[model samples]
Each structure stands twice: as C-alpha cells, then as structure tokens.
Target: MSSAALPTSALAISAAIRSGSLSATDVTRAALDLVSARDGEIGAFTTVTAERALNEAQAVDRLRAEGSKLGPLAGVPYGVKDLFDIKGLSTLAGSKINRTRPPADADAVLIQRMTAAGAILLGGLNMGEFAYDFTGENAHHGPSRNPLDTKRMSGGSSGGSAAAVAAGFLPLSLGSDTNGSIRVPSAFCGLYGLKPTYGRLPRTGTFPFCDSLDHLGPFARTVGDLALCYDVLQGWDGGDVACVDRPSEQASQELAKGATGLRTAVAGGYFRRGADPSAIAAVDRAAHALGASEEIDIPDVTRARAAAFLITNAEGSALHLDNLRHRAEDFDPDTRDRFLAGAMLPASWYIAAQRFRLQFEAAMRKVFSEFDILLAPSTPFSAPLLGQKTMMLGGSEVPLRPNIGIFTQPISFIGLPVAAVPVRVDGPMPYGVQVIARPWREDLCLRAAAVIEAAGVAHMTPSSL
Candidate 1:
C-alpha cells in the first residue's frame, strides 16, 4: 500500500502491520517518501535516516512473520528534536559549532524506550539554536515554517517536531519543553502536544537546556496517539540524576473516563491579561467543552513567570558558558545575546528564583487540592509572521521572542503537567488551550484533553502545505 493509503494514526498502523495487512518495510518507505517530497518546503527534518529506518522496519516484519507479538508502536515512523542523541549522528542542538562534535555512540534514553516498543526512527528534526528562542527561526538550519502557513512562524525549540507531525510526514515525534517549547509549537502547528511533569521522563543522553525545567514529551495529531507515545517513553533511568524512579502511569487507558467527576476551572486574572482575543476565545471554547464554568485565580502567576525566566536563563547560560566565551561569533546572534545577559546575572538572583520556585510549587499544590484541572491559553496569540521581530501586545509593541511563553511559563515554572490542544478561532491560524494538572497527574490532563477532543472543539486541522 502507498503512504496515502496508510492509516492516519500510529496505533492503526501498528494493528495493520500486526495483522499482516501491511508490511513494516512498506510503511517506513512510505513515510520516508513523504519526507522527501514535502520536507523541503516545511524545513521540518534536519536529517532523514532512510537506510536505518528500512532496516528496523524489516526487523519488525520478520518478528510478525515468526508469530511473535508486536509492540504497540511496531511499524510507526517517528522523529525527535535534534537535541536527542542518535547513534552515529552528532547531536546538533541547532547550532553551528555542534557540527564539530563526535558522533554519539548511543541513543538517548527516550530513544531506547521508543525502539524497545518497536517504533521506527525517521531522523532528527530542526529547532531553535540551543533551545533558546520562542520563534522557530534558526540561522544555521533556516526557519521551520508552520505547516498551515509557510510565511508564518511554527513556534520554537520544538517547532520541527510539531511541523513534521502536523504536515502528516510522521504520525508521532518527540520534543523537549523547557518553557513551552512543545506547547507553543503544537498550538502554532495545530497538533496535540504533551509536556509531562518534570523528572517524570528521564533525560539521559539528550542535550541540556535548563536542568531543573527541562522535560521531553511527544507530539501527535490525536490525543490517543500522544498518550500511546508517552506510555512507551515512561521509565526511570539512573543515568539522569533528576529522574524520579516511578512506575509508568498509563494515560491511554484513562482517556475514556473523559472529564467525568473532575473539578475544573478556567484561569482568570493574570491569565486573561495581555492575551489576544483569539487566544481568550480558544481557552473559553475548551473550558466550555470540559463543562468548566468556574473562574479561578492562580496566585502569584506574574511573579512565577518572572522566576521561570530567571531560572531558565541562569541554568541554560551556565551550560554554554565555554562556547559563549570562545565561539560567541559562531552562535546565533539572538541566542548569543540572551545567553550573555544570563551569564551576567548575579548568583543571588538565581538563588532567589530557586527559593521562590519552591514557594510557587507549594501554592500550586494547594490550588490542585481544590481543583483537578485548570484551563488557560497556551500562547498569547497565534503564530506570528516568520522573521518579524516585534508584535503588539497590550496595545504596546514589544520584543516578540521572550513574551510568546507568557501563559505557559508560570505553569511549567512549578513542574506541572500540561496538554496543549488546538482550537480554531475566527482567524485563519488556530490557537490552543492548556489542560493543566498537578505534578505527576498527566492522566488528568490527558482525560481533560480527550473530553475537548471528543466535543470536536479541539482537533488538528489539515495543513494547506
């Protein structure tokens, strides 16, 4: 069967492969063909591992032929953000200098998990330089255009992950979110993306951005597919110090529960301010779909966002101080400047942000004690024009890069789980809403997202590209 004839979801593809209706080799070739034809326009993939993928797919087919039970992701092709280490490929975390690093001898922990579940790896995807920007524009690799509109932005760091899935080149892909990297891109590209609770998924073998805030998760067109990928990727890796040694919490099984008996609220006050009309409308629509009418104010949201910024800058900058000192000119100008500023920050400011972080987490815990889920805008607005530096927010023109994650920063600051579901508004580009749950409660977030998905208010629309 041709790629066009292949089923749209990963689970469906796996079932077809298991039943012998389709061969894993054929499915892998079909996906690679799509990437060959459309990826030039989207700039979604940095590399396409056709040879490696075909070999893996053939192995899956061999197992099925031998009467061995296949894994849940048996023949589904997927990609990961460039930060993830793939054996024999230098992990270019979207920078020019990383091209000189030696090839990785092993795969990232998450990659190992995906391989164990029988998923085929397509290749590495493009991202913002060193996971620093909100806009998807990358100087070394070029911008990863929005699948829905070539001229618009695709949101940052995880932009290629969202673009690849949204464009139908791949059914599932992985991305990292330090501060809204996955959510912002998913919202812009009109896909479902999950940012699991911090330390829930181990980060061994992946490039570091912010040690405390960094998280890796999946992107997909449907909520079930998203959860399926998440379930496969869950486990403890002793290699990663931040990883929590917890058993996998299967979210796919809990999806059918779908917002029943769950207490939900729409975030008000800080969440509503400075947001575009389309963003507010998207949140309202998602809230309505989940039967949430109560408005709740999350305390200290503004300060929480500020604290996140400080922590990210301090921690992220510390990782690249050597490069900033020696190869500053080789760095992306926007990323270099930000890292330089972060280096200048006093130790006291970093310490204070850490102190405030604990207090914020405690406050959020109390909020979660009262409500099961919270709904808010995933971004301030839809994707901005590609390479456009400034935008009007709150009736004043502001620098576009730092402000894109305003709503998302606060929630992630405290290591909460969030699901970003796309909602179509009056505009041509669709915005998204956040389904947030307390730490380690990704099941609740997915259940709420499933309810929104069931109502048809939040779903991925076909990309014109």
Candidate 2:
C-alpha cells in the first residue's frame, strides 16, 4: 500500500483488500505515516508501536496471500486508549500517577479480540486521569486537540481515541464510555462512535471509572466500522464479573438492512436544551433523514444525570481510595478536588442513586417501546478551546465535564447502546448528534446512523493537525 491510499472505513478497506487492490502492509504503512506527520500537533497518542504494527501488517499480508482466512477486521490500524491493558505495556489510564506501574500481565479481553481480528495496535492514546473527567484535557499528559481545529478540543476521556480516528491517523480506536467519554469526543471529531450496551463488551483489564456504568466500545469513521469492531469485541468473559451471558447480535444482519423502515424520534428535555444552534440543526437533519415526526420528551433524564454523577464520583473515589489517602499530591489537580469531594459523599446518597437507576431505566425502557431510536445532540457545543472551562447552555451555567454529558448521561446511565453521529452543520463549533437505542439493540442505533452518514449529513472536516 502506498502512503497516498488509506481507507477510512471498514467497508472500503475490507473490499479493497479482498479484491487485492490494497494490501494490509501498505495500509499499515500509510497509517503510520499519518501518525508521524500529524500526531505531534494533535497529541492524540501517548505511545506508538511502529515495529509491532509492521509485524502485524506482515502477518496479515501472509494470510492474504495464502487465501486461507481473514478475520472481519484484518489490517485495520487502531489506537487503544491508555486505560485498556495491552500486553507488555503499562496501562497508564492517561495519568502520570500510574507511570511506574509494571506492564500488564495480559492484554485486555477487547484488545486480544481486536488482535485476533487482525487489527494492528498503534499503541495507547491519552485520556482524562483515571477516566474521571468529561473534558479530554489531560492535566498530566497535556490536552488532546480537536482534529478539526488545533486550537480546540477532542471530547474527553476518549479524546485521544477520537482524535486518532478523526485526524486520519487511524480508521479505528477503542474508547470506554463511563459517561459520554466515547460519544462526546466522537461527536466533536465528526466521526462515528458507538458505546455498546454495558456488559455487551467485556471490560476485564480495562481501567474502570465507574464499575456499574463503564462500557467498552469503538470509535471509527463509519457506523459499519464501529459495528465491525463491536462484533469482534463483544461476548462473555469469565474473568470479568460484568460480562454477561448474552448472545452476540450479528452485525451483518442489522447492517445488511441498513436504515430503511426504522422508527425514530427526536429527544427533547435535557437533549433539546443547552446546545449550539448547529448541534440542534444536526439533530434536526438526522431526524429528517430518518423520517422522524414525533418530538418526545425523555422523562427522568435530569434525575438520571444526577444519579450518574453520584455513582461515578462514589465509585471513582473508592477506586483511588488508597492513593487519595496517602498520595493525593500525585493525582492530577483537574480531578483531585472532584474526587476529594466524592470521598465525603454520604452512603445513603450512593444508595439513593442506585435506587434511582432502576426507576430511570424503567422509564427509559418504556420510551423505547414507542420508538426504535432516539436522537439528540452529542454535546452542548463543539470541543471548546484546550484550556477553556464552563460552558453556558440554555441560559444556565454548567461545568465542562457535567455539561458535555447533559444529553448523554441519561441514555448511558441505563446501559443502552448508542452511536454518536458527527454532524457537519454550520456552527462556530463542530459537534455531532447522538443516536440511542435500547439495550442489546446496537443494531437499531447503527442502522439509523448509517442513513444519515449515507446522506452525508454527518462528516468531520479534515484537521490542520
């Protein structure tokens, strides 16, 4: 493969390789070249494994020549967020505090699956410390710039994953969504990203911010690519307690039908409020594409967001309990006060949040009974300037981390599958709309998203980075 030819989607690269028009080795080289050229400016990666990628690419080429078998993801180059454990590499979780931790004993289950699928690891990318913050800014590793404009941001804790994909350095990346971590960055980057239903993908070996709420998913240039990665990574793992006995839905089945004949709705309430005008327009455009007519309010969202906050903070504070007690100075200042505050949270409040989860999820499930998919803005606005904090939305002031999750937390809180579609509607900031579906129905979300992408309603601008 020449440096000039890099496929941005699984559909393109897969077909090209199958037909011998493109070789995996060539694609790998091109991807590496992209990283070399643009990553210095974007800070999308915390590490890059050049030799590992080249070796994987060669193995793929051998398989291609033999015409024996090809995994669904053969030859795709991807960046794994630092939180995921990669064999022989220390998992940093984008924090300086974890820099001295020894290399992982084994790859995270999801990482092993991607490797088996013939995806090349381009090394770990940056993220919010301990995956606590919503903004992609890493006070420890420095900020990951938005691919669209170097001056702006890529939504965090999955910012690096989205930036790698959106900057065209890689076609795919792994991200975890504890609360809009994956979707926010994907939206800002104008790329397709999926946060699969909680437990749909095993999280063993992936650092956790919120045990009950964390989900592992993929960021990619297209819904199908996201599906391809999802299919490969999902299934039960005995090592992970959260891994459930759920049958994997066939990506070919849902994606084959595409977006035709799907019932869709535009979400209001939390989703409708506090977004840049362009973000709303993008939602409108997606609704129009899906032929959505009803504009329904998603009830219990405000409570859901509140509950998510309590749970995330509580669990997160516990995860770093020892560190907070003995080595608080080593923690990133960005999340230090927030975690300290959570440490003082009452036990009853945590319990109340759990109780609220059942009520909120029950209310959400009913809404799904009326609609196949729900659409809303991915963020209130595009990624703000690298160091900017506090965004005013719908005439209300909200902190950066919580505000980015405004339209997102309510949906993710209940473990629903969702796809963030990057919308290119005119705005001072670039943002995307999130399309959500009920648990285990990522098919519904991705199918609906494909429609808008096909119509060219969602597209990320090329980055100067």
Candidate 3:
C-alpha cells in the first residue's frame, strides 16, 4: 500500500474499523507490511509480535461484528519502547545483555491498559541502552534512523517510538522520558510527544532508568492521538510507589477550550541563550500563535539541569552496580563508561543534589503561579546527521549527545508536564517547541498545544518513507 493510502491517525483507523469500512486484521497487516518493507532502513523495531498482533486484531473484529461496546482506541495498532514488558519477549532495553534474561510473565501496566482499550501491540521498539543516551545511536541494535532524512539521527532513548510513527509504520507508540527522551525524539522526528507529570501514569513493570525523573508517555502524528493515548493510560497503580491517586482528567475533551483564560509566557534567559536560529524561530512562531508576549526567566534553571544529571547518574548507577561489577563488557561501551563513572560519584553529592531539587521545584512552582504555560525550544536544532558528533550552538561548537536535552532537562527535573509540538518549516528537518505546564497540569500543556496545532503553526507532516 502507498504511504498516502494508510490511515494517518489512530482515531481515523479506529473510526474506519468501527464503521465497518476497514477490518482490524487488514489494518494490522498493512502496518506489519510497512514495517517489513521500511524498518530495514529505519531500524525502528527490536521485536515484532506478528502472531499476537493478528490474534488481537481478529478479536477486535469479532467485538465489532457482535456490536459490542468498544474502547476508545479499539483496533488501533501501537508499539512501545523496548523497556516496557511484553509477556513473552525479554525486554531488551536496547542492550545485548538483557536478551538472555527471563521473559516477563505479565505485560507492563500501560500495555495492559492499552490492550484493554482495544489497542493492539505489535511489539517492542528500540531505545538507548538502559535509557541513557540523547542520540539514538544504540550500539547493540543499530541506531533508529530519522524518517525525514535517513542519514540523520533520531533522538533517543525513545527514537524507535518517534521514528515508527513518523515513518507511518504505526499511528502511535509509547516512550519513556528521562531528561527528554520522548520530547527530543518527537521534536527531531516531527511528532507530538507528551511527558506527563511525574507519577501521573503507573510505571509498574517497565524497566527503570532514573526512578525520580523517568516518565512514560505517547508519541503520535497528531496532538489528539497523544491526548487519546494518555487518557487511556491514566489511573492509579499501587505497584508504583510514586503513582498519584487521582481521577482521570480527560484532556481530549478540554482541548477545544484552547488557551482561553490561560496566562502564557515565552521562556527567556537560559532557554534562549544557546538555541540555534531555527530553534529560536520555532519557539517564536509558537508563542506568537498563542499570543504570548511576556518573556519570563526561570530562575536557577542551569542548576536544576545539573542536579537532574547528578540524580540520574546516581540512581542509574545504583540500579546497575551489580552488573557493572560482573557483566561490564556486555553493555554498550558508551553507556557502560557513563555508568561506571556514575558509580564512582561521592555519596554527599547525590544527597545534596536531591535537596537542591526541592528548592528548584519550589522556584518553578512560583513561576507557574503567574503563567499557565511556558514555551521553549525542545532542542537547540533539528536532528543532527548520524555519526556527527559536534554542532554549532550559539556560535560555539558543542558535543551533540548531552546538549540535545539542554532545554528539556530543567523542566523534567521539577516533574513538570510538557507537550512537544512539531513546528514544520522549509528547512532540511523540522524542530519543535515545548508547551510546558505546572505539575499535574498536563491539561494546560495539551490545550496550548492544541491551539498552536489548530492555527497551522505546529503539526506533523508524514515523512516520505
């Protein structure tokens, strides 16, 4: 099937299946065929559960034939970053070592929720090894290539999730953001990605990166799909200590409300300091669409980023210390070295960083008291070329890997919600702006993003795969 003939959004596919214009089985097969034909070049899938997908698709068709009630995402096909557990597949987490581990007896909580909502899981997608890298250059499995330009890097650790959606292999995918995995890849690959407030969704059964900073969210070609996937994944899970007990906030219903009665601001100072021209322009365009003229400075943002890095290193190192002591060589060299360094950090530094985080969160909360949504560049530039190490930022050359998450780390550090909305331009690759909101206020972020998308300032254009 031609790319143009494929359904562009999850809602479109679900609606067609519901109306009997399409069969769930046929839709699933087309998605599988697309992966078979294009994933060799894109490198998006780490595993494809063909048998399970077919079985689930058939079940959806049966439910439809019986005229039974269906969930919101019925008949939609989706993928998740490899860190999420699928019953019989060993969660590789983009690593060579974990391939030999025992299979998870049950699916991750989010997987169960998605399946319960009638979304078929095709399989696990690739990610950065142990969710550490910003560039999606996984050494164990090859890097997930950008769908826009095959030679450019898809941002990690959610690279596969973004690439698969952008390549049109799937309409939606789940990804984890630790310091910007979801937003970075979404920005680079030209998709809508949401990082919900910390503890908003259950993290049970998913592999851990940094427990404090890690958040699982959805990536899709449109903002509505992002909100749809997020709404379904809501609810409390006692299995996750951080899981917030709350009622589901239907962001899709609130999307039409737009930015009315909301105060908006463009992030200045550190946010604008090192951004490339395209990054700055993208933020400007998004701000203008939302009528945001006030530029607010987020105090001590650089320090927040530093604290986030320290916490990530400390937590990630503690999680992998046993492996580093014995199976060190089994890890990706790039990831292995970083873990090794993290393992050697002083105890006092980690403690101090944790304390600083509370201070930083309080400062950001004060900023939110005045502004409902803050706009900033998601990345300093668009996707960098594959294997290209350095890039020009603010007239100086800097390493590409760590700096890609420069704008994102500060926000996630305080556990704020953000919607990364793609801003398509005539440039070689598209960039995005972060629609940020205060803690537990993803509704605000999605609403502002919906406004930007409705105005034609931000939207996902399918890549020529």
Instruction: List ranges where model 1 is wrong by over 4 Å.
Output: none
The local distance difference test score of each candidate is 0.92, 0.84, 0.91
Look at candidate 3 and give me any clashing residue pairs: none
Best by lDDT: 1
Quick one: ranking by lDDT, best first?
1, 3, 2
lDDT of 2 by residue, 173-271 (tens): 999998899988887788888888888888999888889999989988877788878888878998889878899887745876766777889988667
Put down candidate 1 lDDT per residue, 243-309, tens digits, no spaces.
9998898899999998888899999988888899889999999988989899988899989999999
Give the poorly placed runs of model 3, Cα more than 4 Å off: 1-4
TM-score of 1: 0.99
RMSD of each predicted structure: 1.0, 1.7, 1.1
What is the TM-score ranking, best to worst? 1, 3, 2
Give the TM-scores of the predictions, in the order they appear.
Answer: 0.99, 0.96, 0.98
TM-score of 3: 0.98
